[model samples]
Every structure is written in structure tokens, then in C-alpha cells.
Target: MKVESAIAQRISRDALISILLYVAPIALMFTTFYLTGYKPWQGSNELPFKAPGFLEDVFRNLSSWGLAAIVLGVGVIEFAVGLYENKWTKNERTLDIVCFVVPKLVVKPFVAYFGLQLMPYLLPAAKNIFEWVPFWWAFLIIAVADDLTQYWYHRIHHQLPWLWRFHRTHHSAPYMGMAMAGRQNIIYTIFFSQTYLTVALTYLGLGYAALFVKVVKSLITTGAHSSIPWDKPFYEIKWLNPIGWVLERLISTPATHYAHHADTADDGIGNYKGNFGNMFFVWDLIFGTGIITRKYPTSFGIKHYQEEEWYAQFLWPVFKSKKEGSELAANGPMVGDAVPETETVTLKQETANVAVA
Candidate 1:
């Protein structure tokens, strides 16, 4: 009993330290900005928010091309490392490539353009409401708001049967890598709430902060979905375990996020029902939807997955799967009806019988 109590107390101390490590950078940044007289709450109507010239310059110089370059560089590394086997089917490859290019080239630009245009007309008087916010504060606000929205968006799609079809394409891949991160449906990309939120923040004069947060968020999410277990070493090295502990709680690490894409929950490492965090794992931890084992799943992808065409996965309702019983097919299960009770019971029975046999 004494040993158990000591172990628990030690874990509590380590957890607190880890959280501090994750939060210290944000605290420092906010303090620095405040010392520099960055006050978001005290600005005149004529020159609301009055962003620092350096910040404006940084935002202006930020290039989407640079992001593309990073993606390509990471892709080269993933390929060179042979992270994927013969798992990249023709449909999978096509879907991933198209999803990757189309969003940047078409969807995001269209959304941002229209969002900027619509915001002024819809809320004309509220134009610079949050403009007076300090850059650091604005960045923190946008980061949390954007990430929380995405967390719910992702969680709902998994919890509710109807929305799963749209998200299924992402989990269809048998392997994990940088390419897999972009594998999403057209509707999913278009309806993504964060894109509009970002545009709104830009209009509110946090464009620079929003841009910086977006870059950091992208890196965290991309790293989470990659096949490489980059965080593995931190967990393995005894001295770095504290860093790993805090990191997995603060953001989506490979171990926690990979569990979400794992093929089956039967394996201890695969947790298909939880770990839905995209950029921030804290949501999952707070919402009782996270599981962390510091281990990798042996298999990835959906259970009983039907091989649907790339078009069906990408276009969805417009291009239903030809596979008769597939969830994305025309005559298949309705939204919210993917897993029937009878089917679940039968599955359990089969498992029980196998165990007995």
C-alpha cells in the first residue's frame, strides 16, 4: 500500500512539471509582448489594434510556398525511409495526391476570399472588435478556438454515424505518413470550420498571429500523423520521459494520434473510439476521450473496410461507392446507422466463441 501511494504521488509531481514545460513558452511570449506596451484593450477607433510594424512585416513575408516546400521535403524523407510498403493502392495514392493539391489550390483560397468579403457586410460595425488584442493574446485565443472547433469536428464525425463517411477517407489508408495527413474528402475540406475562423481572425487584425499559429498547428498535426515515431525516443530515454509526458498531454503525439487511426480496438495499442485531438491533445484528455500507452499499433485502417474507388471516397454522396454494402454506397446504411445493434451483438458473440474455441 505504501509503495502504491508513493508511485501515485511521484506521477502527480511529474505530470505537474510536464504541464509547466508546455505552458512556459506561451507565458513568456505574452509577458514579453505586454512589457513592450502591447495592449489590445486600449486603442482608439481610428487606429484600433495598431499592430507592431514588425508583426505586419512578418505576416506579409509569410509565404504559402514555404509551407509547400516543407511538405515536399518531409515527403521525400518519409519515402526515403520506406515508411510505406505496398500499402499505397492506386486509389489511395490518387485520393491522397488530389486531396493534397485541391484544398490549397481551390478550397482554402475560395473560403478565405469569400470569408473576408462576407465578414465586412455581415458584421460591419464589429469590424475591429478584437483588433485591440495583443498579438500574443490573439494568437493564444485563435489557437485554442481553432483547435477546439477542429477537435469537435473530428470527434463528432467519429461519434455520429452519418458524418463518418466524410471522414472515412482519412482512415482508409493502410499506412501512416505525411501524404496520409492530406487524404480527406472535398466536403470535409470545404466545410472545415477552422478555415473560416482563420479568415475572421485576419479581418479582426490578428492576421500575423493567426498566420504564425497556423504554421505551428500544421507542423504539430503533420508530425502527429506521420509514420515516423519521432516522439518514441523521448519516451524511451528515461531522462526525457517527463518531456514526453507533457508533450503527449499538450499536443497530439504520434502514439496518441496513431491510436485513432489504428485498425482494431482489440489490440491494446489501438483506440479507434478516442484520441481525436488534431493539434491539441488536451481536449481529449479533458473530455475523457484520450488513451495513451506509449506504444504503436501493429495494424492501421478501418475494420472490414471495402475497397471503394478514389472518386467515391473524395466526392462521397455525389459519387457513391459501387460496393453494395459499403457505408458510402447509395443503398447502404443511413447517417447515424453505420453499426447496427444486431451486427455489434453478432460480432461480440463471434469473438466470444473464438475465445472458447
Candidate 2:
């Protein structure tokens, strides 16, 4: 009972902090508009700047085939560089490929099409209403709102035992690379508030700003999942340490994000329980959900991973895992038991030689 009470209190505290985090930026946005005498609802034909026609065309293409091209390109590069460390087994490959392809080719388009049809009835008066806002301000507003909302979405999934299965697919991969970046359950993708949020913003005339934010956020998140450790130099180089300090806190970096995927937190470098930032690490810092160590975790994925089938991971509750004790199995527990601390430490020590190579 005391443990449950403590858990309840912690959740309440997190909820309060999340509400404040969500509101602060929006409040500041309005305040900035008021102080600067910039009002989108009041209506103006003027914008701060107009993007070039060719550039607009490029962004449009990026919204479709272009984005897929970029992801595929990066995945190929990661493979060529052996970033998966020979851990991409046949089952892993099937899961990763399906998760990557299905979302882009099937799920997203279905949502966008249905969402467009539904928005007219749901928000009849809101289409293109805020079109007058300047491009830069719109970009800033969308970036903050989208990322923060996603931070909460992600954090809650980890906190709530029932929702863990929905997110389990993302954490099942034993390796980190571009392949695992888009690897997620179909239901998780369908209910991804970020997609709907962006769509609603675009409907309200922030389409232009949404385009830029989507591109930038995608690159940042994908890079963070890569095994490249691009942010390492920032921590290593003496003069750049100052820049690293800001960069790690300001946005998600490979080092910070990898910790979130670490198989165990026993090493102090691994922190699967926190670091819920997506595009911006600032949200984690603000809500006290992040941890940063310059070192990468020696291992990753769930300590109790049962190698559930791809269909089970991607379509759970609809299709259950056949693996007897898997979390996705029928009548399985909401969350799996963690590997014992002693076992985890021993496993890490044994894997150390392979991890360093």
C-alpha cells in the first residue's frame, strides 16, 4: 500500500509538471505576440518573408517521396557502415522492414485522408484561420507544441503499465540504427498525436511552418537513433564542451537518446526509465525526466525480450505473441519483469568486449 501510494504521488507530480510544461510555451507565444503587436487572428495579408517557389516545391516533394528517400538513404548508409553490429537477424529485419514500410505506404495516408474528411465536420470554422502568422513564428510555435506534446505522449506510455505493450515494439530491437528508427506498432502510429496535431495545425494555416518543422524534427530524431554518436565530439573536444552542454540539453542527441534505450540502468550510463525526449531534450530537462552521460550503453533493448513475432509486436491485442511468457502473448502480464541487477551487471561485463569492438 505504501509503495502504491508513492507511485500515485509520483504520477500526480508528473502530471502537474506536464501540464505546466505544455502551457508555458503557448502562454509565452501569446505574450510575445501581444508585446510585439503581432496578431494572426486579427488578420493581415503580410508575412515576414516569402519562400522561393523552387524551395516550396522542394519542401512539398519532401513531404512525400522525398522523406522516404532520405530515410532509406540513411538506413543504407548505416548498413554499409555496419552500424547494426551483426545483430540484424532475420526476425529483426522482418520487423524493421515492415514497421518502416507500412507506416509510410499505408497507415499515414489512411489517417491523413480520413482526418481531412473528418476535420470539416469537427472544426468547420477553423480551416486556414491562422494563415496570417509569420513563417518564423509559426515554425517556433509548432516546433514547441508538437515536441512537448510528444514528450508527454512518450512519457505516459512508459509510466503506465497498460500502455507499455503499445510501445514495446520500439524498444525490442537489440541494436540501434536507422532501421529501428521507424520501427513501431501500427496502432501506436495510428494514434500518434504528433501526426494529428501537425495535421490540425496545418489545417489552421500553419502548413508552411509545419513542413519545415517536420523535416528538421525527423532529421534530429533519426540522427539521435543512429549508432554514429555524432554528438560525441561536442563532449570530447575541450573548447566544444561548452557547445555540447547546450546542445545535449537543447535537443535530443545520440548519447542522451541511447541511454533511454539501454537494456539496464545498473551501469548508471543506462536509463531506460527516463530520457523521453523526441526532438528536443529540453522537455525532459524541464520535467526532470532526463539523464545524460557522455558514454553509450554497452547493451540495449528490453532485458526480458522474448523475441516475439513481428505481427505480435506490431499488431498486439489483435494478434498475440506465441512465445509463452512474452509480454505480447495472450493473457501475458502488462509489463515484463526486469532482469535481476546481478544478472544484468554480469551480462554487461561479458558483452563489454563485443560492445567495444
Candidate 3:
């Protein structure tokens, strides 16, 4: 239980910058509404676009069952192509399976059911309030609100000390693929604010837009986490470089996101400390938290990873890791930032160091 680096001791100036980034979403939402001359409270809204009834059903399905099937389907393809190689051990498989299944089958449904039941009481007059907003505007607003909210949520966990372990399971994977795309700690999955935000938007009559946003976000993030590097074509093909420039900046690409999972940030291309964007890479760019090297890292996961038990990785603090000297163990350091090779200190010099990484 001897603590070396105390992450709680300090918050970097960059983290404070991240805090300021929260205003971006709020400003974007208001600006969009102002320019569009639309206000949900004014109540003279009109449906922006009318689609075939079948298309509505299709959108609904894609947002719901289609997303799960797509993740599983792409995952199977990744497995068959040896994208995981020998990295997905039994422990890794258990954690990935549980994370993928439990959240979709159990936690999300529970949250939706309860959230719907509580909505009437929570915001009695707010149900279907924004239903009249144009489809495109609603989509634009929801995209910024959900993604930016999640950007800060994600960035905070990495920069903050006490919250790192909750998100550490995600970084523990040694390789990238759909198999580990949904891998997350139970608590982290349970309290994810993005889910609640989406649900609230759906209840506020933006269900159609929310559904579309959800599908698009899921595909981008899933693809970003995939091992295939499908985006390379955009970078490699001379004709597509223009599109690639905008595309990579606009959304999470494998090149950018994989660098975020890299085991070491010392490499110019690897940036485990930044690249916190999920669906959109623009947030990283706006907040100065992203690096685009157009290169992939050689390795992934935490430098101090101890191969903690799957159960502990999935449900830590409730089930502590049995591995001694492990971060998830009953008594271990709150934030175990890896010491740089060049970092040296005399034993006599004692001071609290923040785990900035």
C-alpha cells in the first residue's frame, strides 16, 4: 500500500482547460437554436421531414438491435481474420464478453425502463417537447451535446486521479478490435452520463434524431476501435487525402483512437494521454488534446498493467484484484502512472507527484 505517485495531489492546467471546454457544447447548442429561429418552448414547431413509415421502422431497428448485431458481426470478422492474434486470452475473453453482453442486455435496458418511468415525474411537462424541431437541426444539436458531453466525461477520468481505475479496464486491452470496443468496468458502464443524456433527449421528442445519432456514433466509435485500420485508404490514396483530412478531424479514426490506447506516449505517434474523443475527433482538436501523426502505435494498454483478473477488471472496488501490488488490489496506489525512463529522483527528495497521464 505504499503510494508512489498520488494523482490527487494536483490537477494540471490542461485539465482546467478541459473544464472550460464544457462551455463549447452549451454555446454550440444555443447558437444553432438562435440561428435556426427554433425554440422548443415557443411551441410552434413543425416536423422537418416526413419519411416513409418503413424508413422510420428501419431507423428504429438500427438504433436498437441493429447496433448490437453490427458490433458482433464486425467482431466475428475481426476474429476470423486474426486481428486479435494471441492477445485475447481467456481472462480477456471473459472480460470482453461480460462487458459486451451485460451492458446491452442488462444495464441499458434497466436504465431505459427506469428512466422512462421517472421521466413523467422528473420533467412532467418536458416529454416530446422538441418533437417539432427539424430533423437536421435536431441531429446537429444532439450530436454536439452527446459527443461533447462524453468528451469531457472521458477526458476527466484520464486527467483525474481517483477516477482512473474505473476507466482502466478499457486501457488494459493489449490489442484493439470490436471485441474490446464495449469492454468497460461495471461501474463505469452503469454511470455513463452519455446514456442518460441520450435517453433524456429521446424522451424530449427528439427520438428520431437521437436514434439516427446513436447509430452513426456507434458505427464511428466501433470502427475507430477496430483493428482493421480501414481508414488507411483515406490516408494512402492520393485522391482521398482531401477527404481524409476533413474526415480524420471530424470523427474518430483508427489512427487517432488507437494512439490513445497506446502503452507508451513517448513515441511521437502514440498519445495515450490525449485523443479522448469517442465519436468525434473535433473535440480533441478544439480542446488541444489530440495528435494526428497518421501512424499507428506498436503496442497498446497501460505500461503498468498487471493482468488483473477479469472479475476485478469488470467489477473492481466491489471485487478487488487478487494480484498483489496491483492497482485494483485491496490495498494499492490510487493512480499508478508509469515512471518515465529518464525520470530519476534522489530518495531524500520527497514530494507528492500528480499522475498526469
Measured with C-alpha atoms, the lDDT of residue 58 in candidate 2 is 39
Model 2 residue 53 CA deviation (Å) reads 5.3
Using TM-score, rank the candidates from best to worst: 2, 3, 1
Candidate 3 per-residue C-alpha lDDT over 205-295 given as tens digits, one digit per residue, 9 for 90 to 100: 7766776787788889988998889999999999999999999999999999999999887889888878999999997887688999999
TM-score of 1: 0.76
Q: Write the per-residue lDDT of candidate 1 for residues 291-332, one digit (tens) a residue.
A: 999999988887657878889989998999899777788887
Could you tell me which residue pairs clash in candidate 1? 40-132, 162-336
Q: After superposition, how far is residue 36 of candidate 2 from its true place, in Å?
A: 3.7
TM-score per candidate: 0.76, 0.83, 0.79
Every candidate's lDDT: 0.74, 0.77, 0.76
Off by over 4 Å in 2: 38-86, 340-357
| Cα error, candidate 3, residue 285 (Å) | 1.4
Top candidate on lDDT is 2
> For candidate 2, what is the TM-score?
0.83
